[model samples]
Target: MAQNVKRRERDTAAAQVIAETFPPNVIDTLLAEAKETGTPIDGVDGLLNQMTKAVLERALRAEMTDHLGYESGDPSGNGSGNSRNGTSVKTVSTRNGPVDIEVPRDRNSTFEPMIVPKRARRIGNLDDTILSLYSRGMTTRDIEAHLREVYGVQASRELISNVTDVVVDEIKTWQSRPLDEVYPIMYVDGIRLRVKDNGVVSTKVAYLAIGVDTDGRKHALGCWIQDSEGAKFWQKVLADLRNRGVRDVLIVCCDGLTGLPDAVTAVFPDSIVQTCVVHVIRNAMRFVSYGDRKAVVKAMKDIYTAPTLEAAELGLAAFDTAFGARYPGAVDVWRHAWAEFIPFLDFPPELRKIVYTTNAIESINFQLRKITKNRGHFPDKDAAMKLLYLGLRNISSQRGGESGTGTHGWKVALNSLVNLFPGRLSF
Candidate 1:
């Protein structure tokens, strides 16, 4: 009798294991067999569901708490060291899956989570999805549809806007943050945006500043909106940068904004200003005939691509002799901007590439344009500024490093600046 009872208990345990492992159909079959034998298969679905949830919760909690350096019920507690507010755990429903998170509480109640915090009951993964989509140049409607189809979660346009807007304040603070005392190379440029004011939409300039540090890391200094580019506005921007701790900029690459070189000289008297060769060429090309564009561009290239300053001067003289009658204006622009244009000629080939153009800032403006492509026009200057600033922050945060080319050139240029300035510049 004891042998028979033990065998029956073993058989029952085996059946329970099978029910848990197999699909719903298999479990139903096992339940039917139990019913026929006047036995019960109770709480199987609920138990299995609870067990799965517990396992997932444990894994997620472990991941979240790993770097926190605290455990449950410790007297000193969670590295925060406040005992009055015990740790509160909250369950958030996310699109990827549900997660159990520990909410850190404090006496001041001012600890706002920069990553993911309590009261953010929606899925944390959704923010990542939106950011990813935004980076890939997706429109708001497209992002909304993607979230709906991929995650089976309904996210509204307004919600998406609000989520992206969270970066605005952060961007503001970053813009005003202290910068390194010396930047080897600084690139400045502007992109045009349509902004509405008093019910009229007009073009506004979005100015950008990109700095290359001593270690070859590229940093975006800040962005601002202005009616137009001029010496005065640029002086203000430079002053703000100086206030933010930029003691010296070695070489400033810019387009031909009149008096801009003077502005840089005024702010950082020792800094060299180089006009963008690309911009100068493009501006020159605009005055040439379409039929002669190819030849004209070739001549212009010779002027910038020459191996030395003397060779470049020879190339420019040849270009003037060749096209002076057909496009005298183009030749005159080169002559006028020659001072700014020729500064790059004084540098080594490695340094010339870094200081010859404002491509770094232009690349950043391209990204800004992509982010604002879908918007018809901003309502005001503030709206335009906010969007541009946030877009820049989003880009810088994702790319994680300087967004520029010619690192070797930047390093060489920086060394030259250090030699020229002696002790005034610091990294």
Candidate 2:
């Protein structure tokens, strides 16, 4: 009896390791079937379905044997009360197609199969399929139609919603999770989306923050939904980051939102606030004509790309002289943002590139925009937050599983940052 138990344990362990190479005989049989039937090997009635059925049935059989503590027809099981009671036919939907297989039963009726649960009608990681589709911005109705048409599975809208609803709690936990003690670089920005409230649709801003750790790997700190972006709301966001364990941030990159720089320094006095150069340029361009835009852009590049802070100021002066009269507002933008913008001019190119703009976070916002474009307007705040959270998680996976980006030339950038901020950047 003990030997039988040990052998069963060995079998279970072996079954857990999926074989990379299948038996040659099985392949030959499948090929022969396809040739004889003149069917594609990967179609509904093809090798995948056959293999899925065989693997599921085999797993069920193994489960039954484990449950009974003895193999079929073993004399040691002659007096065992919970003996095999054969199997019942069960049809399950899979990615390939519908597969009908046998589910083993026990005499005592306690054999619960894990591969295909007692009532599970569909298989092949369907929840993941729904999430992948949902993260890619598909509506639940769209996902339902996609499953039904592509996989021949009749999934209801409610079922699809329930699958994605699991992300709500995940978002809550992720938002409040503890962060690293210090981040080398941080970028914050807002993207607008519509949400419904009290039967009225209003535009709301989704504020996102991305932090680059000491290792130079980017981590999406969190997302916040607000009626509008302001320093008061940003103070709250910064406080939350502090409460969650972020002690110091070397630099905070953001747009020229009024009082935003004060909010950053208020929360982390040691942190330098760097206004995004791209935002400054865009704001300046807003007041320029299409014809003069090229010349203006060229002049503006001289200021930002200057080798020294004094040189950049000279470049800005040169720009003011050339276009200041016609595009005074454009020149004023540079003048207003000059203090926050010149910080990059003091750094080497490697470090400057890392902190010059909030482009890293903007890329993430672009992806979220794509996800929410079809949404029109979310029914409520949580609905909007849930979808955005899932979208970020999906985006992170696509960019090599990091919350932000594994920036190219990160090693060189880190070395430059280390030399620039003596005691600030600790591993």
Residue-level lDDT of model 1, residues 305-392, one tens digit each, is 8888899899999999999998999999899889988877777666776777777777778888887887788778766766676566
| lDDT agreement of model 2 with the native | 0.85
Q: Against the correct fold, how does model 1 do in TM-score?
A: 0.70
Candidate 2, residues 24-116, lDDT tens digits: the string is: 686688788779988776646777788888888988888888989999899999878779887799889888777889898888998888989
Best by TM-score: 2
Error of 1 at 410 (Å): 4.4
Poorest stretch of ten by lDDT in candidate 2? 1-10
- For each candidate in the order shown, give its overall lDDT on alpha carbons: 0.72, 0.85
Worst 10 residues of 1 by lDDT: 41-50
